[model samples]
Target: MHHAESLYEINDDLTPELMGRVDEVIQRYANRAGALIPVLTECQKIVGYVPVELQEYVAKGLNIPGSTVYGVVTFYSFFSMVPKGRYIIKVCMGTACYVKGIGEVLNRICSEFNMDVGETTEDRRFSLEAVRCLGACGLAPVVVINEDTHGDVSADKIMNILDQYT
Candidate 1:
């Protein structure tokens, strides 16, 4: 299917440089079977998120349908369609964490940041997410900001912890 205007026209952020990078990635894996995933991965690394425009661009480059690209992007939990914040704060909501009052911690972080779960702050400084588990039951009520994991976090300590990121 042909679009009225190119994806670049619709999205101001889809610059020529980004399109060039996408083209390079597609060219590198054009003849390879199952190249969509790797192409999308490389594009996402450069652009942070796989926007609809990027997906369409990838589809066109790979000579595939846009729906196929969309399917792959949506099917993968790690793929994000929207831009992520500078800091991604993941609150563990596992049974152990819940029992230890993770709810309060989550609430405190959201209330302080003025953002709900899976939402990014207006400043794009932080994105809050309540995950099923962080695989650290021993450190019940854990909060991971980027690569730094803070175990045994208390609701009151959320601010101090976030301060380190800024």
Candidate 2:
């Protein structure tokens, strides 16, 4: 989608009350250079991601320069530039997990969904990510779907775990 359209599309998920809150925030710190962070925090809360166009809108709304907003957003990893999927799949690639046949598990996921790490599916139903560890070394070969953790997972177990999200 076009970047301009993407900014307005954020309103689709944001309630009128939330948008009003965003407006209030902008008005409150319209003149402060440091207001960029709070404004972004509110925007991210209302819309899960902070796309480039939204950054521009926030800058314009607060009479701040676009570069100022862009700089702050890019500086933080918590602020996502791209849209996130409803289900976030985190595969543990830590040393312990990797040694325990985690490679096969990762391969299975890549083949099944045709997706690589940091990529989301076409339907936007799932986003695949690989993390260093989930602190479940005991449960090596761990695959986390959102908050739920699946440990000692095998290629066969992947389907059962994914079915929960669908």
Candidate 3:
């Protein structure tokens, strides 16, 4: 069991209503074997991200160790402890994209936004991520911002593309 002081401070967005939803999800899956993943998924859907405080809460609710929850979260790329921004910017880092100058595109974005891959902007506007591929090899050097994809992107054109989001 973790002491209160050792747990993460819950954010304001984690309202009673949200916690109630999480609790209901937990109750539904707590007794089932291999329930952790689904429970976490449902919680993430409600909370946007699964912070440590929520993890501990889920652990206790499911009668599982917090370390196990932490392990699963850390092992999964889809899981994130920090809240994601409104827009998620995914830059393809595949061989084709890299060969087509995605590195420069990524660098330009990082320099302009003052953020690295897997980091959200200070204003919580954009979150940048480097992905292995987007499966658009024909459209190499793809940058997907939110649901829109820009193929054959150039480094100099990144800022122009980002302007459309705001």
Among these predicted structures, which one has the highest lDDT?
A: 3
Q: How would you encode candidate 3's per-residue C-alpha lDDT over 1-166 as one tens digit per residue?
A: 5433334334665777788888899989979999999999999999888988889988998999999999999999899899988889999999999999999999999999999998999888899999998999899889999899899889888889999887
Decreasing TM-score order of the candidates:
1, 3, 2
Better of 1 and 3 by lDDT: 3
TM-score of 3: 0.82
State the C-alpha lDDT per candidate.
0.87, 0.81, 0.88
> Could you give candidate 2's per-residue lDDT for residues 1-166 as a string of tens digits?
2233444465454445555666777788788867888889878876767776667778788877789888888889878887777899999999999999888888888899899999888887889999998899999999999889999998888877898897
- Full-model lDDT, candidate 1: 0.87
Q: Tell me the spans in candidate 3 whose CA falls farther than 4 Å from its real position.
A: 1-9
My TM-score estimates for the predictions, one after another, are 0.88, 0.81, 0.82
- List the pairs of residues colliding in candidate 1: none
List where candidate 2 sits over 4 angstroms from the true fold. Answer: 1-33
The RMSD of every model to the true structure, in order and in angstroms, is: 2.5, 3.8, 3.1
